[model samples]
Target: MNDKLTRFLFEDRAVRGEVVQLQGSYQSVLESYHYPKPIAQLLGELMAAASLLTATLKFKGEVSLQIQSEGAVKYAVINGTHDQRLRGVARWDEGLQELPTEFSSLFKKGVLAITLAPKDKERYQGVVALDKDSLAACLENYFLQSEQLLTKVYLATSLDSAPKAAGMLLQIVPPTSETYQGGDNKDFEHLAMFADTTKSNELLELNPEVLIHRLFNEEDIRLFETQDVLFECDCSKARSAQALQNVAKTELLTMIDEDGDIKMDCQFCHQQYVFDAVDIENIHNDNFDAFNSDGRIDERTLKH
Candidate 1:
């Protein structure tokens, strides 16, 4: 599959790696909004990173990578589930003459938040500064601080008519033996050195197997089954109706009176859900106590 992820382990070393390629799913996210070139590129890289990070999860839930800032690009987030399903969205300041190329310029005081949301357990979130030049570098810094493990992340994206993104992650597994002190492993550094040689074009265009072989021809590696990655959004009319519950009943009635119906658009997928007065009445009458459990904002106010 063009959109798939593969996991591999170094048999003789305490290192694990994952490779992810995205094309169809990447295109789907771009199609939902007319994003600027830089924003589109950022989203692609985030998607790849999210996929790689999601594979590291041992639970049945999703991982979200979010960047919040006060600069031109105000907010951006990509959510990826354990099964590789993904979706993303971004918001930026309007009327900007040009978008900045540097990460710091685009996001003043920006912080990257990595959140692990489990299906049945409490969610965990870690934050790191966006001081690095690229997302890959920021992620590496995160691994060093939060995980205390050496990690190498390579992310590449092509914003062509058919957008594509791919990434590789190599990490030193936790020490299991007394000899393996809490630090970088020699074998991991060796493999990471080889992985760093991969060019952006090679990552986006080469097959996963061929790329792996080219990077570590001498290492004994065990490749696992490939998992498909898809662009999926869970926003629905019912969910939109449920979201209306967040608004005050008087406000809902006022909106319906002013427009004859209240319209809600999903920020992620741009899907529009319209609710008439009758729909609003039923929504209030129904017992949807768990409406906000999903934590999805179905109604977004347009900014001038």
Candidate 2:
């Protein structure tokens, strides 16, 4: 399936929905590392969830969905931007030859954190416990606690050699005094009932139009234009250089003395950036061009 996110609205019910399917982007994430089946599956769900939630952003920024746990999986996160770019990674126990199959066992004592960072506005974050068996259920609870908007989420992922993930989100639009007359809780529940009947394979394989029809054939639905979603990592040599600036000049030089160079690897995409003694010197001099001559990453230029 093509990587796309589609938004739709229930004309009379005051409800909004989004459906997202990922194939190429999903493969890009899985190829970055040799993730176990369970980890890959979990990352796939997180990727889909990130795509669905990022669509709600009205400003220019990114959304980060992270899970911190003390179970077999230590940490997992997916980052998505307002324009639908996504990247994700997961960290698991390195010693385990075979990962556990039980969902609860995999993420013991886990907490899910959803953060929205806008470029020109203050950031907001919501935290919730991962007490549910599925990621979808956890997200549903997050919306309930944070926004108090009746919401439902369904996430599904394929475990085959070529991984794919898809998700659907339904939310009740906040009611205003004039618009709240007939758009009651029952209307939202009626549509949610149809959404709950979606099968995993159907969500993973079916196209958006067909899937929407299957679920809400009788409802007055207005499907919006599709938005493209892809796996694009923001890591680059320039950003790596900027990150190094956070370290003291003396410390950076000491690292070069010990190892002959500094290496930075992005966990999300596994791309490596190497900086030698000269590169470190240039970094300390505030010379960004030496490392980012190609202009691969958009780094801020500092005035001397």
Best by TM-score: 1
The per-prediction CA RMSD against the true structure, in angstroms, equals 2.9, 4.3
Tell me the lDDT of candidate 2.
0.87
Q: Give the per-residue lDDT of model 2 (tens digit) for 1-304.
A: 6899999999999889999999999999999889898999999999999999999887899999999999889999899999999998888998988998766678878999999999868999999999988889999888877877778999999977668999999988876623423234998889988998999999998999899999999999999999999999888888778777777888878887888778777777877788787887888888988766443333222211
Number of backbone-clashing residue pairs for each candidate, in the order shown: 0, 0
True lDDT of residue 32, candidate 2? 83
Model 1 misplaced stretches (Cα beyond 4 Å): 175-182, 287-304
How would you encode candidate 1's per-residue C-alpha lDDT over 57-129 as one tens digit per residue? 9899999999999998899999999999999999898789799976667888999999999997999999999
Off by over 4 Å in 2: 176-184, 292-304
Give candidate 2's error at residue 137 in angstroms: 0.7
TM-score of each: 0.92, 0.91
